[model samples]
Target chain A: MKISCVTTFLMCGNFDNTLAHNLFYVNMETPTQFISRIISNDRISEGFFELSLSWDPRAPVPMPGQFMTVRVGSLAVPLLRRPFAFAGFDADSSSAAIIYQKRGAGTELLAAARPGDELDVIGPLGTPFVIDTDQSKHVIIAGGIGLGPMLFLSSALKSRNIPARFIFGCRNKSLVPDTKMFTDADPQICTDDGSAGFRGTVADYINTNVSLDNSTTIYACGPSPMLTSVNKIAQSSGARCQVSLEAVMACGVGACMGCAVPVVGGGYARVCKEGPVFDGGEVLWERM
Target chain B: MGANVDLSVRIGNGTLANPVGVASGTFGYGGEYEGLVDFSDIGAIYTKAVTLEPRGGNAPPRLVETPSGILNSIGLANVGVEKFISDKLPYLRTLPCAVVVNVAGASEDEYRRVVERLESGCLDSVDTNGSGIFGYEVNVSCPNVHHGGLAFGTDPAQVERLTSSLRELTKRPLIIKLTPNVTDIAVVAKAAEAGGADAVSLINTLVGMVIDVKTRKPVLGAKTGGLSGPAVRPVGVALTCKARRAVSIPIIGMGGISCADDALQYILAGASAVQIGTANFVNPKTAGLVSSGIREYCIGNGISSLKEICGVAVD
Candidate 1:
């Protein structure tokens, strides 16, 4: 379960010296079709569920911010795999977890899944967030189920002895994830109803309290609108920012070119390939 | 019963070691799925469509999932044939299986030019010991493009002219991929044969459109897209039967072939070989699975060769 950093960098060919660049270069090891066994599928809130699967130690460990395209059912009803970001992993137990809210037919089927069920998965696909070590302060932001990757990123950052603060924003107190889940960092929890922590949105909380400077690096994952606001704040304040994007993908690989997001420059970048994680400046927010 | 089944069969002048091959566009240049799939187990790899000039393809939302199927409006996005030859062909030449370049163009002359370049460089002289491409699969059935795709494929005259011209360009095997959008695929299949094509493959995606009720617009970037998957398998089988009765040449059957049973239906319908398309998107290892499954099926049925069952349903 211990991922050898030397082996990881060697496997990922283009490893530059900088920690941020090295994170981006983490080779998405050739994807394999793994028949993973579901260890637990627990409903945490009204609609959200935290599902964990026993992992094969041989399979490449998915880095924080990367995702897996999971097949919901044995039958081809949905036909396409639903992509989910890594929420957490227990190397000692050889299990990984994903947090999701029941939304469509795919998630509805996933909600019906129970422990001891076998699920087909292809991953650890897509790009991971680049953690800039030079930045003195790191801020992790999550919106709703976007907390999945943020929690995973928080743990990874902790392993590097880097300090990070978590800011979570949801609709109300009932929607917030268990505070015990984020024991490493005291989260600045915010709810729209003012029933839990801060009264405004996570962006509003950051705008009011957090100070962004050249030494600040912000990592955010959430709804597109929330990401747009955070991206704007990062750009205006001269702080480095990386955001994880979401899209409906047919093939998690680049062949289908289905999950494309327009970048700041001109052409489209495949979210399943070039990113699910991208620099705030690289993305064309309005175009998305 | 350990029956020694010969999955290998002849297509055009070339021979495939097995009947299962990955379809064009599904398998990208044979390099994308390298470590994920064992190339030695596959019969051939048909690369994504290559045109005379590089094409950017359609805008976002190029693909959407339907019930047991998928609609794609990729617009045949590919690196130009020149770049394909320079950048992709070298890696393809190293693969253990046969390689078939899927070529597309805006016009017949454009098709001829691409084939001429491929022949002079990649396909012309095959070192008996060295690895090289087996043939060319002419893609005239792409529904996403505006130019020579379905436009040239639907018309029998255009199919004949395009096929005949490309046939004259290279000694390598030429397989004309037919469009199901035509009124009668049999007529187009016969047209390809008349043009001296070595073989024909069908059915390309059926033209379909999905409307987003809330937005009141089509879901795909291209207003319409080609539909493929199990939904199109019956249509593909029926058309393959019709084309088999109409033409004497070999037929490559495709459309919604996800498992060995689906592939067996195509062989029984008259396909000498089968290609796995949209299923590749759903399962990257489908081709390998189908290959082993075919062998398992042949052994279970006590059939010694695939040719025994091919076209059995048609006769």
Candidate 2:
């Protein structure tokens, strides 16, 4: 009933897809918050770091495209939790990892973290990526720091015995994550400077080289302009596209009403709750 | 277990089971933290401010983390009065904690109308026997909205009239949330009490600005937002004490209260109760921790009731 009003108010008398609404908003399972010990903290590349933590056995294992918020400090400054998408998850070991860039104060604090350090984490949060069983092919795209969830999605597709084309974009070879970290799902690297596997942007290569059709599904996580371009490409080829978003988040829960992004419709949706992953068609590219 | 220590606080006709509460805006309508935070330990839940109509809120980048706080310009985004009764109120009714409806509006009549609807419409469904809507926290202090937020709070006369008008509407506690952005918050507190307000909560966020160097643009879509968390704790404590000095009504204090020790600063300075604000985003268990910690402090110090410490730290 609460969700109905929230959904009704957010719906601008223009929604035609209840399936998408249910998949993204309704029937949400509550998230769990717990203290997890850091298993490993490593700088896997220049400007990129990966911190792995033990997952709470009682909570549901975070699926591909889902994110978590880590309490960087116990005090007031750096007051809000830092949100990170799950880059990798090992079910048997009951562990999860986030590949982050050491850019701000939050990640800087996170970089100093060591093995066995207790970290407060809330997770298996937001809407997870929905994989279709009948799609003939999948295309996974990740850009720099956005590699976190895309990396997880690539592995998810592989486990289901699905074939996919993986492309990861970076400014240069140094900014790219180590190939060893992505052993589970091999990705074709595309650097702006042509210092890696393929030259030019990920969208550039896909527009020129990759063939898309109704049978193909495109999954992406990247900067806004790149996503806008990818969505255009997918739309032109009649391929369904899902783009994972990144935003400065405060509660990471639905409460704060921060981390809002405009959808294709008139109203705004909480990226922390309604999604980090939104269908490309539902996105307002011009607004971004 | 310090069960003998009386943690409850009386505000007008309503009584808070304990003194620790999650501030409005930070706790949503109490549904967001259901599974995450233990609600049984919470004394009250001040829900997100409800306006006359649904608000879309500010655009993206509504929040930013500062040194020890968060700057937010959520623009009082909410589900409105109708949805509040139909959607939010039911879930809040089920919570063990006291529910305080935080009301905000663009005009005086809007505020009155919302209060009127809530009091009249919720007569039958409210679990007053249990812990239902015990009171209304008037949010004239919200800095994010353009009209009827800071505009109404900054003026003492406006606050007084607003308080009295709403005061005449219901028998429940009426807490006027004071904004620290004002030059003299005590003046407003005195007005609220003079207008027959049951209690007043202080202090709302201080106006702050953050600029991005690269883009040469403001971090928030709204040029400025309200600052909460530890950054404003000292300001909140100081203003809260000033209001305490001027008014006899119970004062509910909040700023960057992350734990009980911080809450004690307000309590000692004269606050009867305290609300956990930005810290809720950091740790949802802060209410439980703060309430328990306050209990221990009371027991250790041989303090039987909150009256023993409140107003001890005089100006």
Candidate 3:
């Protein structure tokens, strides 16, 4: 624990001074850590799984783009908790879900999580995506497992009667999440191998199909390369963009400056604190 | 009768209410852990290392998850001494626990200036004398930094010289944070003691690295980082024990400590105090829980003070 990234360590300074930042997390009173029983842990597709857990209703309901760090195991072999954005949060059921791809030791352990088993969770943490008032043509894009938060955002947008051009990109048809929830989003599927809708990457689809304008707002989540591409596409179109980034975090809270992502400014930003979401132009893409 | 069991221990001229404290980098500036951890249960909160100027730290991929632990090359990225005074100190000043600013720098002058700025900068904001800035934890053992971190820590003369020089700037407490990547940890412990240090904190992270087989590249941007967590507990406990016999000054023990029992291992090995490090990432309330568990163990065993159990296992 003698480690420290001597950056602008957080308290009030991590998050930006935007209205959305204040609206969502301003009085996040009594951040609670709880143990929830796994309601279900089901594989939705090849190398992809969905975990649902009972929630402590006392804790604030997680907004779209918000994330939780789940303790996948009791022991230290898989040392740090895996931070996953909320794929779903149902206050009525008092449960939440995470859609994760089985990649590392942590998710591999999470894949084996069974119903009736208990897991520790700390959340509704980080800045949530804001529904801007200008009514810009909203475009929500998800790449592979990045679909988790974007899917949550789409449903929330629909409930608010906010329509968006939804796109989900993956390697092929087999990589797609096989869930009723995914189908509910009514997303345009783009596949690399032409096994689905539009052929090639999400960048290719944006370049060939969608015509963006200054009034456009791009909201995205996915791998770094895809996010970098989104940043570029939005930049060229002069569209405002808020990207949800995925970074490895030792401490899910702002405490550990381990989850740093390079921004346009001089110093690095802790992705766990300042964002899993940031302005497209704010990030220094070349460094990423 | 168990209610009267005392857990108070010494950290120099000042008394630590308990032996449970959070490590430097893991705890950040204490305010970062607002709603999650109860500050009342902790004995100390070692703030992140502060330098003369702000540090951008290493490149991305600063952290990598190793088995039972983590490897980090954060490179001491901090908001500099000026910002630490302006931004981080206010919240740290209000914490119920003791606040120890962990200081790091590339050169000896940078370290001196950082402490000097803190000594003078905290005057108007603080009401109680020297209460806002509790003490200093000189981070001579940080392995990730290319400059004065482990370099100063590994040499006995440099440790002694730096400790005594910084000793002149403050009277509160000077705890030299030591690294384990050395041939002899005791010589360094004795070096701090010889330099008029109030206490010594042992076993900063051991230098380690992780590689991605597919890419054939190092996982961390710095290529090598310090390893901490349960993986380093034995190394920490062993070093804590070694330093205890070498120096009479209080020994603050840390490394891979997650539980009260893990802390107890250090206390039995002669650590006057213990810190919860990587475990904070797993659970923020770990220090408080560890405190409670340690108290319960003391009461159940009919031990009057934690000092009785300190270093009991060594003989």
Index of the highest-lDDT prediction: 2
Q: Give per-residue CA lDDT, model 2, range B176-222, as digits (tens).
A: 99998877888999999988998999899999999999999999999
lDDT of 2 at A41: 90
lDDT of 2 by residue, A129-171 (tens): 7765458889999988889888887776666567788998889
DockQ order, best first, reads: 2, 3, 1
Give the lDDT of residue A31 in candidate 1.
64
TM-scores of all candidate predictions against the true structure: 0.94, 0.94, 0.94
> Model 1, chain A: how large is the TM-score?
0.92
Docking class of 3: medium
* Ten-residue region with minimum lDDT total, candidate 2 chain A: A6-15
Error of 2 at B167 (Å): 1.5
In the order shown, the candidates' DockQ scores are 0.58, 0.72, 0.70
Candidate achieving higher TM-score, 1 or 2: 2
Worst 10 residues of 1 chain B by lDDT: B121-130
Docking outcome class, model 2: medium
